[model samples]
Target: MKDRYTDFKEDPRFKIANREALIGCGVAVINFIWWFGFAYGLGSKPVDTYTYIFGLPAWFFYSCIVGTVVIIGVVILMVKKGFKDIPLNHEGGDDL
Candidate 1:
């Protein structure tokens, strides 16, 4: 039998990290908005537990959940796109 898939990119591609980072950035934005709203819209009061990164509220809780889901979804999508090792050759080895 032959392996169904191979490594994505010759070595491990940065796609996974890139996707996770992208997702984290996005989540950060959302968190910023959420905190900004709470801070400015609701009141200029900052939460005691969390501190600001650059004078902005740190929405840690929300970021964790949303970031994880977003990153996993992105990685799964890349995998579905045949991002894994290239199609195997008939000679029983993966084609470069």
Candidate 2:
């Protein structure tokens, strides 16, 4: 059976918004996994045995610096390509 809010759910704006939100969440999850994997997986080693890259520990460089760069690039790409600029007005009738 059709729900009362079916029309609202099927609207293109909602679809666009849902897609954008999903994209954002997906990126966040990917970034988190990347950072956690490097920070813990590689960083678990003894400090004396740690590898260096550009004068920083390999895990620190990858997890903190590279992860930051990757997430920023993803966000910029999403904003330029994936996100939409939807209007804020539902209607004058719905205004307070």
Candidate 3:
């Protein structure tokens, strides 16, 4: 296979796709944390204060929900379109 950076720039969609993929990955992480916190915390809400980056308690809670949805949506978009042609790198070319 070819080196990713060498060939990725050839596609004009690469930049936009790269940005979307990064955003999508970030969303996925945040979503995973939100789910983990929700399952573990059991309805105990996130607090908003000087420690909180968003604003208020309600904002934090709603943002988590929205983040979850956006993350999943972006992931779907990435997997369905952005990565359709990328070959997977593997060891031994068979084990994976």
TM-score for each predicted model, relative to the true structure: 0.34, 0.81, 0.36
In model 1, state the lDDT of residue 18: 63
List, residue by residue over 18-95, the lDDT tens digit for candidate 2. 899999999999899989999998899999999999999999999999999999999999999998777756742465
Minimum summed lDDT over a 10-residue window in model 3 is located at: 47-56
* Global lDDT of each candidate: 0.53, 0.89, 0.58
For residue 42, model 3's alpha carbon misses the true position, in angstroms, by: 3.1
The prediction achieving the highest lDDT against the true structure is: 2
Q: What's the C-alpha lDDT at position 7 in model 1?
A: 36
lDDT of 3 at 36: 66
Better of 2 and 3 by TM-score: 2
**Stretches > 4 Å off in candidate 2:** 1-4, 7-10, 91-96
Ranking by TM-score: 2, 3, 1
lDDT of 1 by residue, 1-96 (tens): 236565333333455556656766765676566555544553444567556555554454335444456556655764666344532355446666
- Candidate 3 lDDT, 14-34, residue by residue in tens: 566677678777766877777
Q: Candidate 3 — which residues are off by over 4 angstroms? A: 1-9, 43-96
**Over 4 Å off in model 1, which ranges?**
1-12, 44-96
State the lDDT at 54 in candidate 3.
Answer: 52
